[model samples]
Structures are given as C-alpha cells and as structure tokens.
Target: MKQNLIADYLSCILFRITGFFTCFLPFNISLFMGRRLGDLIYIFDRKHRVVACANIRKTVAEGGDWRAATRITRKAYQAFGQNLIEISFIPRINKPYLEKYINIVNKDNIEAAFKRGKGVIFLAVHAGDWELSNIICANLGFPFILFVRDQGFPRLNRLLNSYRLKQGAKIIYKQAGPRQLIETVNKNQAIGMTMDQGGRHGELVKFFGREASMSTGAVKLALKYDCSIIPTFYTRVKGPYIKVILDQVYTVSRSGEAQKDLRDNLQRLAGIYEKYIRLYPHEYLWTYKIWKYGKERELLILSDGKTGHLRQSESAAKLIIQQLAGRGIKTNLSIQEVRSRESRQGLISFKPDIIISAGSSISALNYRLARQSQAKSIVLMRPSNLSLKKFDLVIIPEHDNPPARKNVVVTSGALNLIDADYLKEKSERLKRSGFIKSALSPLCIGVLIGGNSKGFSISGRLISTVICEIKRSAEELNADILLSTSRRTSPEVEQVIKNELGGYGRCKLLVISNEHNNPDVVGAILGFSSIVISSPESISMVSEAASAGKYVMVF
Candidate 1:
C-alpha cells in the first residue's frame, strides 16, 4: 500500500511539473510538443488508429499517396494534441479565463434553454476545441454537468474532469458512476454530451451513404427527463478563440412504450448528424470508425458484390453482411475492382471471394476491366437498360422495378443502412441518458438550416420570420420549445433568429453551429412535435424529419 501511495504521489508531482512547463512554453512550442505526442499516440494506440484508418480510407482510397495520407495522419495527431492540451489545463480555465478563448455566438439560445423548467442537454461533437464547451457554458452564468467516458488514464481522467469542474461544470464520469449524470440533470442542472462517437451498443444508421453506428444515450435522456435538448458545436476559425453555436431546443412525445419511442426518435436524430458531416467534410473527424460496430464475430467476406449498377451493388453487400451477422456470422469488408488500372493492383494485392458492380463499376471504363480480374463479376445497376448477360447476377431497387432476370435480386428499399428497429433502439437510449425531454403541450420544433448553398440562402428574412413564429408558437401554447439549427446556418441568420426569439418572453431555443452526433435533440423534437416545421428547399433534411413516422410540416 505504501509503495502504491508513493507511486501515486510521484505521478501527481510529475503531472504538476509537466503542467507548469506546458504553461511556460511558447504557444507554438507547446503546439509542437502536442503534435509530436499525438504521432506517438497515433502509432501506438491500435484501436483508435484502426478506427481512424477506417475513417481515412473511406474518403480517399487506401491506395492514396503516402504523402497525402501523411498530412492527414499528422492532422489527426495535431487534433489529439490540441484536445489533450486544452483538457489538461481545465483546472486553470475558469469563466474569467475562458473569456479569452471562448466567444459565445448564441447567448440567447442558451438563455432560452435555461428558461425551460426542465434541464437542458447540450448536444455537440468533437469538431474543434470541444474542451472549451464547459468553459463557454460556465461563462454564460448557468452552471452545467458534463457526461463523459473516462479514457482510462487515471491521473489524466481526474485532471481533465477536475479542470472542467473548476470551470463550473460538474464532470460526471460514465465509468465510475453514470448515475451522477442522471442525478445532476434531474436536479435541473444542464448536462453536456458529445453525440458523435459510437456507443458500446449503437443504432445502425446511414452515414456518408453507408451503414454507420451512432450513440443513443443523448436521445434517451431527453425523452425521459421532459427537458430541452440543445444543439451546439464549436468551429475553429483562424483565431484560437472559439465561435460557440447554439440553436433551438428539442424534445419528444412519450405516449408510453418508452423504450420503443425513444429509439425511433434517436435514429431519426442520427440522420441530422449525417447531414452535418456531409456539409463539412474537412471539419468532420475523418479518423473515426463511424461504420465499425456490431458483429465482428461474423464470417468476414470483404467482397465487392456487383449486381446491376456498381453504386447499387453496396445493397447486396450490406444485406449480406447483416444477414450473415444475424446468424452469428461476422463478415469482413473489401472492395472488388476489375477496373481503374490502379484499383486492379489493390484488388489483386488484397484478393477476396465475391465481386459486385454498381453504376460506377459497369461503365464503359469498367466493362473491359472486369474481364481482367479473378473473381466472378456481379453487376447490379445497368445503364442504357441493358441486359446483364455478362455478369453472374443483377440486383435492382424497387425504384425502377425492372423485370427480374435469372440472377437478379429485387429489393424494396435502397439497401442503405437504417431501419425502424435501429431508430427505435436509438430513441430509447436518449431517454435513458436523461438528455431528452418530451411534451405534448407546446409544439416542439426542430430547425435545421446551414451553410449557404446555390439552392438555399443561409440568411434571409423568410428564415427570420420562421424562427420568430416558432418562438411565438411556444409562447402561445404555454409550452416549452425545443429548437435546433445546422452548421451551414449562416452566422448572421443564427443571430437574427436568436434576436427575434429573445422578445418572445422565453422559449427553449438552441443555437448550434455544430450538431454533435447526439440524436436526442432532433429525435425527440421530431417524435413529439405536434407539427414539424422545416424549410422546403432541403429535401434530405425534410426526409430525415419524416423518418420519425410523424406529421411533418415543411415550409
């Protein structure tokens, strides 16, 4: 016992010593050390690296040049360094001090959240200096509780959590006692959670057009607590100072069947997270195994199944993976490329059993190339409505409802991920986490608008009016409101909405420049809202809200 105590004492001393040195070093020098440390961590941490590599390969091909990969590799390291440094200094980051780094972009949104009788769930992601979340909230006057997983580093855990607490956040550890989070929030204290990372168990959803698992606790909590779910995130602009984005509040309707309702709501919430990642690719944390979860025990077949069109081929692959895993058969994933001269090398080097082709694969470029590969080709989708005489099988969605040939498999829905069951599961978790609050009284509204696009305007008078009406509706109903926006939402537009809502007495208005992967805010809003009001231009966004199996009112 004495020896253990001595070691613990020594480690604490070392942390203090290092902290002092870190504080004194020039910012650049500290940043350099952070990058170097990040590299060491990236190379050494097998699990995190595996997740990271999976994320990386999805964007650029695995055969991408080492030079380009190196830059991303270093950036991952840099991000880790930034996260570490900021977290370590949590002890020193009081509200007064946080003012130097955190700039509140949507103060009124947060104020509105506090005004709600129920507690608030601040749902966000790890896009920028996420550690600053606690500090920003602390400076805003309302103290909060932060629910987080302990990274297993004993001193580091205590240090980081302590720092957040010092900044006026009650850091609730998921491992030692997650109930503390429930207790804190139940006391009407604000709870902050990151929505992006995968949970031990997750709801399978579509991300980047593929099957990805998402955390469900955020949604579950909101459902159970009858609280406001707030959408929030931070963007790293040129300055070290952060721009905190918060928008509208969200809550769900609970008509009993708590578990089923929550999961459905959460899966729908995951859809919102998917849209944000698509909108900001560079800002998205690319080094995460967003698609890595579930039955790793199933038989692994890394085949690139080809049906009709190459793009549609993934349907077969996804169906196969799930069906096999369902029978206790885990599978591995691989791409089969008989075309793209460079892709051929990758395939041969990493041979697998089956090959599938979709639209991109059966093109004129790939037609001749398939003859060169070893595996049998399965063409899924065909252009020119041609017969798949050359391929083994063809798979098509009900979209075309083409007449089936010998090897064709007809599916009703596009074989992308996400099912009602997955949605149900996610919704339940959010309820359990107490991050969700549901009500039938006032209309719960979810707002998703972001970066200006050629087809849409981020800032406009119409949008401002919509926000004002939403707030007004909440006031008239004598009900709490849940409101949220997206990253693409213009800074000006966000401000206008917040400004307009400030006059409405008080409503739970959440302004999120960043939507952490938490589904609670959006899920509950869609699930409970008497009528979901959305912008007409963003069809994808509209469809996501529709996924809840509710009445969706689009403007």
Candidate 2:
C-alpha cells in the first residue's frame, strides 16, 4: 500500500512539473509543440485518437471534411497546453488581478443562485481553460471549492494546488466523499466540478453516437444540501480573451421525488456540454477516449423478410440511401452478420440513422441485440421483452397490428428506391436538351411492374399479356404505348418488353435496374406518362408515381 502511494505520488509530481514547463513556454512555440505532440499521439496513441475520431466523425457526418476533423483534434492538444499555463500561473491571481482578467456571463444567474445562501454546486466541463474558469469564479467573491483528481506528481501537485489556493479555490480530493463536500458548501461556499469525463461508477449518457460514462455526483451533492446547481464554461476564443457563459441555474427541489429531480438537473448540465461540443466539435477535447462506454450508433441487419416480401424491402432501403446520397448524405450498408457484432458491443459502433432490421427472423435478435445498440433501437416485428424501453421503433407491416411508436415510419405497402423528383427533373432536362423527344399520342399505355412478391411472380407470361392488352388499348384509343416498370421489375420482363416494343416507333418504354442503353428511361416515363399502371411490388415506386402528379393505375 505504501509503495502504491509512493508511485501515485511520483506520478502526480511528474504531471505538475511537465505541466508547469508547458504552461510557462511561449504561446506560439507551445502551440507548435502541442500540435506536433498531438500528431505523435495520433500516430502512436491510437486509442485516444480513435475516440477523438469517433467524436469528430459524428459532426463530420453532416458534411464536415476529414481534414477539418484532424485540425480540430490537434487544437484540443493546444487547448490542453493552455490549461497547464493557466494552472501554473494561478498563484498570481489575487482578487484585483483576477477581477481584471476574468469574465462570467449571466452574473444575475450566479447572483440569483448565491442569494439562496445555503451554497451552490457549480458544474462545468473541461472544454476550455476550465482551471481558469474556477479562478474567475473564486475572484468574483465566491469561495469556490473545486473537486479535482490529483495527478501522480507530488512536487508539482503541491506547487500547482498551492497556486490554486492562492486564487481562492478550496480544492477537495475525490476521497473526501459526500461529508467533506457538504461541509465545504454548507457555509454558503460554492463547490465546482467538471462533469464531462467518465469515472469508475458513472452512469451512461448519449454522446455523439454512443454511450459515454458520466458522473452524477454533482447533482447528488446539490440535492443533499438543498442548494443551487449552475453550469458554466470558459472557452478560449481568438486573441487573449475567453468567452465565459453561465447557463441557467437549477435549484434543488424536493417537490415530489428528491433523487429523481437531482439526476435530471445534473443531466441538464451535461446537455450544455453536448450542445457546445456540437457547435465546435473539433474544438472540444476528444483525445481522452470520450466513447469508452458508448454503444454503436445503429445496427442495420440486411436480410430479406420471408413474409413481407424480400426484394421489395431491400430495394426500399436502398432507395432511401440512394436518394439521400443524391442529396449528399451517406454512410454504408452491410449484411446481417456484418453488423451483428455491434449488437454484442453497443450503440456507439453501428451509428445507424434507422435500424432497418429486415425480416421477422431477426426480431428476437433485435430485442436482445438492440438492447445494447447505441442507436434508437428498431425492430421489424413484434419485439419481445416488450417492457424493455430500449426498443425505439417497431416496424410491423400495417397489415399486422403492432404497438404504436413515434420511431416507426410505416409505408402504405412496401418501400422501394427511386428518385421521382430527380427523375422528373432529369426528364425535363433531356426534353429541353432534345435527347429524347416528347410527343403526344392518342392513347398512352403506361406499364408499371414488380418482381416476385408474396409467392406471386409478375412473370414474362403476365408481361406478354399486359403488353398485348396495352397495345390493343393504345390501338383502340389511337395513342402510343408508354411502358415502364417499378424498381423491383425483373430484368427478364424488361428484356421481353424491349424485344416486343423496341422496333415500334410509337411505343416508349422505361426500364430500371436492368441492362439498358438508357438509364433515364424511368425518369422520362414518370415525367411524360399520360396514364400509368404501376405494380404492387414496391410502395416507393407507387408513391413516386403519385408524387409526379401523373395518371396512375396501381395493379
């Protein structure tokens, strides 16, 4: 035990000495060294870098470039340097000097909080010069006692902690527990704590796409003392200035449930960190393994549902992803086995927008596996363990009665992938550019198709009949035949249509996902069809057909 203490003491000492050196170094040189050190860590300390990248990836998912994420990560290292500098210089912060340099927003919030007079629990995160944030609070006539974890260095810890004391911060080591913390704040003194980092027994909270361990001690402390809890942070902006903001204060209320309110209030403070982190995600410190406990974002099981029709659902998700891609949103897709590990791990890894857990076969897995996933859990069937609140969405076909949920986006029939608007717009461009001439006819016969569904294959036999009927219909109306297919139409049927109709000048055909000389055929059909007959295979194609405001026949 003594040897263990000795090692811990030495570790603390080494941290302080090095911290002091970094703090005292010239700002420009320090920044240069900081970034270089970050690069070394990025290359060698792969774990922390992975966390930083994960955090960066979430914000970057919205179109933030990879290079920008890298730049922001290195900036976190530089911010760490500033933290050391601010702490090393803490001794120089007398009340007058402190008053001149420090600024806190929402002073009224602080004053209103202080007026309660029992004490205040000030919550914050290590987002910026957090040590400096405390100095300013101390100088503002608040006897602030900071809850801090001691490093493994003795001399520097003593030196640095002594300086912290000089700035009027009453520091408390973690071992002091609830009694000491209550006492410190009992005499109308404020207790300050940084709540962003994970701890041994912390609860999990959503950060980025995963669960991260977050301490609730500060909230617990405030409730025990019936004091006020306030969250504040000081972020380093351009030049030598810092932007300090004190958020709304929460009073420890016991109107009904005492402990419940406390947890909620602490969570409120944590949200402020998440809010700010998103704004300048690159600026936030992510090098400390922020996602150590987070679950995967999403787990998308790529499977074909036996009952609901396989090719149709697969085509639907693919359609959404394709449309989103056209609009520049992207991730990736994988088979059921590929994303299954995320079920074992948690939510942070999969990072799904929506878990399209295709097929009823995987419904049981969704219950067990989704319980651990980070994303809003989605299952395709009636998820068992119905009491498990983790299941965010249950997408049962409307035909079957499933429990109501806000997370579900049910289709009228089945989902398919097709960009009707993009298709329509492209058709217009082609018409304007004169690639495919649009000519009016006496009778326009539009053919909409689906592949195999619910044991019914829309065969070439059926297509040959439909084609013959359509030709007769067009002949009776003295108009041309306009042939088209849903996204799920088999290539064989499309080939049959081309073979039967290609030589005819008056007939026009649009085929999708088939080997064809023209990819814009589907677009032209939707844009120009006077009357349309669509297949029952894909709801998405029917919907797209409807959206074009064209004449539609859903068979």
Candidate 3:
C-alpha cells in the first residue's frame, strides 16, 4: 500500500511538471522542448524504437531505402511529441483562438449534414492534432460527444478529460455501453470517434497495402441512425496552426447482408484513412503495430543439412518475401532442417502457403509436407527420384540442362543470398568486429575447398595440385588467401593444404569439423573476397561465388 501511494504521488508530480512546461512556456518554446523530449524518448525507448523501425521497414516507399525509413521514424516521434504538447493547450482554446490559429475548410459539408435531422458521425483517425478536433466542432456550436479510450493512467486520463470538458465537449468512455452513443445520436449531436487502431477481433481490412484489423463502429452507428459518416482530419500546417479538412461524407451500405455491408463500409473508411496517411505519413501514429495478425502468409523452408543448399533455399525465399511485400502482403518464414524422413514430425504443426527446398535429399519430404499442408511446393535443383510433376515449381540451373517443363524456372546460375548491399553491410560488420583486417579487404581471395562426395574422389595429388595453383594465383594477383574446408574434407587433405598455406606470407586456413565451425566466416569471405577458388565437389559453392559477381576458378 505504501509503495502504491508513493508511485502515484511521483506520477502526479511528474504530470504537474509537464503541465507547468506546457501551460506556462510560450507555444514555440514548448514545441521546441517537445521535439527535444521526443529525441530523448527515441534514444531511451528501445523497444518502441525497434517496433517503429520495423513498421517503417514494412511500409517504406518503392525501391526501399533504410535511411529514408530512419528519417521518417525520427520525424514520427517528433510529431507525436508535438501532438501531446498541443493537446495540452486545448483547455485554453476558444472561438478567437480557432479563428486565429485553426482554419476550418469545407464547412459547407458539415452544414449540409447538419440539415439532416440524424446526427453526424465525424469519422477520424489518430493523425495530426486529432485531440484538438473536438474543440473545432464544439466551439462552432455543434452538439459534440467525443468517444475516447482511457490512456491507462488514471490521473493523466482525468486531467485530459478535464481539458475536453472545459472546451464544452461531452465525454463518453469506450468502456461505457453503446447506450450513451445511441442517446447522443438520437439527440442530433455530433459524435467524434477514431477507429484507426487495430481492434481485437475486428474484421481484417486493407490499409497501406497490408491487412489490419479495423473497427466498424462508425458504419454501424451510421446505419442504425441513418446518419452521415463524415471523413474528417486536422493536419498541422505549421508550429501552432492547423487545418481541419472535412472530406467526402459517406453513407453506410445496407446491402441486407450484415457481414458484406460491414466489410464494404469498413473498407471504404480505411481507404480514406490510407489516402490521408500517405500524404502526411509521418503525422500518423507509427508506434502502434498497424499490420497486426490475419495479414501474414506463412512460408516453410526445408533444408537438407548442407550449408550451401540452405543458403540457396533461403535466397529464393528472401526474393519471394520481397515480392510479396511489394504487393502489400506480409510473410512469415519457418525453416525445417531435415536429415531424414524421420524429421516429418517436426512439420506437423506448421501450415504453410508455400514450401521451398534445395538438394535432392529433401525433395520427397518437401512434396509430402506440401501435400499435407495444401501448400504450393517449390524445389531447387533436379530431383533424383521424385517425379517433377509432384512439385508446383522447379527452379533449375542452366548448367543442369533440365528438360522443358511448365513448372520449371531455369536460371543462369545458382540462387544465392549474397547481394551488393548484403556484402557491404556484412563487410562493415566484420570490420567493426575485427574478424577481417580492413587493409586486406580489397585484395582477399577465398578458397572454398569441398572434399569427397558421391561420384567424386579427392586424392593427395589433387590436393597438392590445387594448393600449388592457389599459391601461383595468389602471387600473380598479389592477394591474401582465406581458405576453408567443408565437412567432407579428409584429414590428410587438410594437413597437406595447411602445410602448404601455413608458411605462406598471408594465408588463413579453417579446417571444418564436427565441433569447430564459424558461420560468420562464410559471410566475411563473400563480403571481402575479390576472387574465389573452389573444388568441383560442391556446385552450390561455385554458383554462390558467381552469384556474388566474384571472379571464380574451379580446380
């Protein structure tokens, strides 16, 4: 009990301090202070900052740039801070202030709607200066009721409500029954409501090209009272000036079917919100998770326990995810690493829209899982035993000379996860982490040594021959070598290569084994290497080298 009282007292004291700054400071000074506070919040609020960046990445403009998202996210925090500070000034607003600072555009629309005996539903969203919108309607002598959700802080909530009441706006908490809303409409009063936030159990509707749960309360109330649902918003024009835009008013559709009518009306409202938000994107609330559930498609990736195969499969899936995002769809990716048929139990709970895999080992598993989940099956490389028709999409390399088929997508080289941007980012990370010397980055040659495999044998002579060729090439190109072997490399082969490259001036050999492996080395090699040498045992490694646009030599 003592702790609770102490916390409440501290909260009230902090609230009073904020009120002092907002209430006493000049408008411009308060706005400036609010922006600084916002920047501080952006630094300290780590969780919300992550959520905001994720939301921004999910909705960045075409040709997605990370820097653009960063700039907008920063501005979004500042806009939110400005909104709060301006909302604090609501209690002091009157007719003179509205006339001087607020410009009401399209007043004719509201007047025409008011002529109809049924009340008007001012359908709005959480955009610029939305808290002050009620003052616009109330000061103009419109009988107004603002339906608000609690801010989760009791004292802060009451303080904000006091401001609203002082402006002659009636308060109706969302938790209170709809009886109050109906009574207000029956009395021919304007009801202000915002339904832009995702509502629990709300119907899924498209917003910003992605699905989000949207509340249909405004449509329902309009249908019930035969009222006009006016699309309205107040956008901040400058530091202390605002423009209340009264956009096109809509009538609820009474298509006789409740579900259809509700969905159509809700979609209409969401469309309007999307237009305004796009125009003033930074002004919209971004901290809220807009693309909530019911908007994501699931993709399952089947791996064959090979690093090269996993990289290829992941590359293709990454491209598909990007394409989906371009079309306003969200994707959830799940990987199932299958060593044998016994791994089937791992996928029982996963329901996928598409299944993708590389290597012939998991072809049968991919087919079975796709069939069971009713997902489109996509496989990379030609299968050894399974029929091609079993899979929906077959992506094969041009070197394989696959037969002409409707489901086949033949490419020039193997798909790989490495791209220019990815390489640059990884290189920066490696430089920061001190794994690769910054001076050697431009002239590094990576040797990807694969050992014995099916239909292939690695002899001691072959090892010596490859090592001599690598040494000669390194001398000719004046490059340092970053050599690594695969799981299939024999101990004799490792010793031979280690002995040869060990005494060389600038060479690093990583012997792969059961317990000792560094996944990051692969990224570092791809990022820094100007050229790559590979053994013929693994075609995936060769393909990845060529895909990254590196000069490749197969020994």
lDDT of 3 by residue, 1-555 (tens): 676666666766665677767777888888887788778888888767656755664564333344566687898888778877777678778888888888888888888887787888998888887878877787888788998886656776777788788999888998984999999888877999887775667878877666788877888788778888889977778878888888866778788888888888889888887887778777877777675555577798998888888888999899899998997778999998778656765565565668999998779888876654446799999986999999999999998899899999998878888878877776677567654433673588888888888789888788898888878878888888887787778888878876787677767434354336656566667777888888886778887777778888888
Better model by lDDT: candidate 1 vs candidate 2: 2
Per-residue accuracy of model 2 over 265-320 as CA lDDT, tens digit each: 65566677778777655456666656454432232654542322333445545655
Alpha-carbon TM-score of each model against the true structure: 0.51, 0.51, 0.58
Q: Top model by TM-score, which number?
A: 3
Candidate 2 C-alpha error for residue 432, in Å: 46
On a 0 to 1 TM-score scale, where does candidate 1 land against the true structure? 0.51
**lDDT score, residue 534, model 2?**
75
In the range 1-555, model 1's lDDT, one tens digit per residue, is 676656666756666776788777755566567667777887787656544544544444245333444466556666666655655465556656656666667667766776776788888766666676666776566667777785545665576566676667766667765577677677777888876666557765555445556677777777777777777766554324556667566676676897677656666665665555444433456555465553442111222332112223454677776777677746666655554556554543332224555553244333333333222455554534454665566656566666767877775544432346645665566567654433235445555554565656755687777776766766676656556666566777767766766444444445453544354545545554556676665433565566556567776
Model 2 lDDT vs. the true structure? 0.62
Off by over 4 Å in 3: 1-12, 60-62, 298-308, 311-457, 460-555
Candidates ranked by TM-score, best first? Answer: 3, 2, 1
Give the runs in model 1 whose Cα sits over 4 Å from its true position. Answer: 1-15, 39-50, 59-70, 175-183, 253-260, 275-288, 294-555
Q: How accurate is candidate 1 locally (lDDT)?
A: 0.58
